[model samples]
Target chain A: MRHRARRKVNQFILHCILLLGGALMVAPFVWMVLSSFKPSLEVISINFSFFPRRWTLANYIRVFREVSLGRAYINSLLVASCVTLSVLFSATAAGYLFSKLRFRGRDQLFILTLASVMIPPHIVLVPLYTLMNRLQWINTYQGLMFPFLMSAFGIFLMRQFIRGIPNDLVEAARIDGASDFRIYWSVILPLVRSALAVLGILTFLWNYDEFLWPLVVVHDNRMMTIPLILGHFTQAEAKFPGESMAACTLVVVPVLVVYAFFQTQFVKGISMTGLKG
Target chain B: MVAKRRVFNTYIILVASIVFIYYVLVCVWPFAFNLYLSFRKTDLLTEDKFIGLGNFRFLWKDPIFWRSLRNNIFYLAMMVPLGIVTSLFAAALIYRTSGIMRKVYTALYFAPVVTSMAAASLIWQLLYYPKIGLFARILSSLFRLDPNSLTFLQNPTTALLCIIIMDVWKDSGLRTVIFLAGMDEIPDSIFESARIEGASEWRQFFSLTVPLLRPQLIFVGAIYSINAIRLFVPVYMMTGNPPGGPANSTKVLAIQMYQEAFYGLRFGYGATISMVIFALLVGLVILELRSFEQRWEY
Candidate 1:
């Protein structure tokens, strides 16, 4: 009876601790969301309450009205979608080729791609900007989308994944006289759908959060992405605290939603990708 | 049959060509240009003149460049171990728990990893507000310290430290999740045998768990080290761009490169700093890969 009582107490303590940690982890996001709805005065008030006494959608309204917040959203979505699609297609094709095709210097070429991961983007930022300038692609869609079209990491990941698919399956497709493209499109893509899912999420996430390149390339406010806009907002006075919070909240929500929807894949992707690197 | 063969070769060539060109354009060409630029002497308005190893010599003499390099190393030194150990502990704690609670705690820890650094840093900048900030409030309540007396980010003593702490807070979940996955791979039989031999929890953890998790430790360490070197956002957003307050204590190599390139428009000088960063990263990568090979055998 005493042991049972002790066990019950231990369980309660564990639950309390874990729950508290969960609350702590989630508090900032909750705060960001909640504070976005509060009036500007209430946001910075020392006696600020957790829940707003007067909930208003005015901050969101103001963000949309004053800042190019809506335009930034569309810009992020368009740029990220294009980049993600391009990355998916090129990476999948290249990964398939590297994995299956009989090629000259395949291993050496792969190592060359692997080496690209080490060259920090900052190393090439100036030259890339120069290149873009020369091409007259600055502030253009192609300019914004050009550098991100093929990810070495994505190609490497797809190679690892395609290597796991049984060779006999590809052989079977070939026997049916299915061409390489057909096999990749119909047979291989379906089989490696999980890898595609992970890659898609990562590509979207990175492009969505990309700041410096966009900040540099994009001159017009209409072309600015959410992170770039947020930087602009920060540079502006900190007086519009509510609008700032709302804008931050807007920049964050899509990632949160995607992450929530695909938490398992997201976790798996991060861990597996880390191991690969 | 002839048509099919023709089609296959065409497809293969098409893909190969596209991949090769894209690789060269995006990855290879940029580095090549960076290499070229780094060797030249050029300002914004002048034509770049080839000056072999002169830019590197200039970098060698630059005090600010060296200071930034030193600061980055200091930041990495503080961040890497704290990130690794705290995450490992957090993962262990979560792994020890059972049922749905595990998922709940794991999700909470991972929340920060998914959020944008811009948003998080912005929120934290508010939290770091000197007098009315959460840090000040907590310190004042617990230790009888004055809330208004603290100057956190503006002070050299605490600015870098604050950045490191914020980084750990924002990213430890990723490390924890990684460690948890590593720990999950340890077969139950090993722990069962340890228990049968009357091993204490400490013994089991130290002897069985730590040894088993060597590969993961190396992986997490290497990854976090690379990430620490690229620590841009927290320093940039939280400390502000120039890192130019009381002292430029928080200026890192990436930020320096950025300023040199974009702000100063000395593309050649910026490329030089970038090459320096690349060399430092390469040095770290060599160390990491060696550790990888050693741990790989186990």
Candidate 2:
């Protein structure tokens, strides 16, 4: 009875600590969304409240009118979708070759590609930006999508996932006179649908949040993605706390809503990023 | 038949080479070009003039470059161990628990990582709004000091620390999840045996669990160090009005590189700064890849 009581106390302590940390982890996001809905004055009022004293869409309306928030949103959607599709294609095709096909210097080529993940865009942005300038691609959709067209992590994840499919399936398809392209299209693609989903979701989230590249290449407001447009809040932070909150909410809520629907896959994809070989 | 197979094999190889060709264009070529640009003088509008080590010599004396480099080092120093160890501890605790509770805790922790970092930083900026913000309100009452005087982000001494703390919040979830997955790979039987030996829970963890988690810890360290060195969005978003301001306290390698290259139009000088990051990252990536390959053997 004494041991059981001690165990119960320890468990309770653990619960208290984890729950406290969990609240801290979740509070800012909740605060942002709630505070955005609050009347502009209430957000920065001396008496702080978690919920809106009187909810309003004034902040959102103000932001959309002053800043090109809607255009930025559409730009984000376009760039993210295009980049995600391109990354998926690049990753899946490379993954198929790395896992399923044999070619000269294949392993070395893969290691080279994988190394690209470590090479942050900042390092390459100058030269690439200059090149884009020469090509007259700056502030264009092509410019925004160019640097992000390939993802090394996507390739690596797809390779790891694709490696698990039984070789007999590929060979059997070959015996049935299904061409290599057909095997990849039918057999490998179907088998790796879950991996593709994970990569797609992850790719979309990452590309949408990408700030530095967009900030550099996009000199015009019309070309701005969500992050580049968030630069608006910085202009007069002290004057408009509610506007900043609303912009943040606009940037964050959709991603969270999507994550809510695909929480398990997002978790698996995120956790696997480090742990997967 | 063999000739036909050769043709088919070429088609497959051609398909795979698409990424390779694009990789060369986007990644490889620019890396080489950046290196070359580091040694030359041009903003791409002017005629490219070769100037050997001119950029580096200037960067060597540039106090801001040193400051940027120092800040990047400080970021690596503070963020890495705090992120890794705390996440490891958090993961270990979560691992001990069971069922729906585990999923809920993880999802909540990971919520920030999925949310837009730009947005997250903005939210944090509000929370640091000296007078009416949460930090000021709490710290004021607890310490019996004026909340108006806090000025956390504006105060140069505290700015970098604030960003690093917020980063720890944003990122610890990722590290924790990674560590959680690593812990899952560790067999319960191993702990069971340790328990049978009358080992304390702490002893079992310190002895068996920690040592086994060495690769994950190192991998997370190297990976995040590369990330922290290239820190931009958080610093930019958090520090308002001429970012890296209030004495340029929060300026990091990537921010410096951006300002120099894009705004200042000192293309060669900017490339030199960025090349520093590239070299540092390559070393970290090598370290990460070493552990990464070792993970397969494990």
Best by DockQ: 2
lDDT scores in order: 0.80, 0.84
How much TM-score does chain B earn in each model?
0.92, 0.91
Model 2 regions more than 4 Å off: A47-51, B1-10, B290-298
Docking class of 2: medium
Model 2, range A203-235, lDDT digits (tens) per residue? 898899899889888989899999887877875
TM-scores of chain A across candidates: 0.92, 0.91
lDDT per residue for candidate 1 within A195-243, as digits (tens), equals 8887888898888888778877899988888887887655442577778
Q: For residue A275, what is the lDDT in candidate 2?
A: 66
Each model's DockQ?
Answer: 0.51, 0.62
Instruction: Return the lDDT, model 2, position B9.
Output: 82
Candidate 2, clashing residue pairs?
none
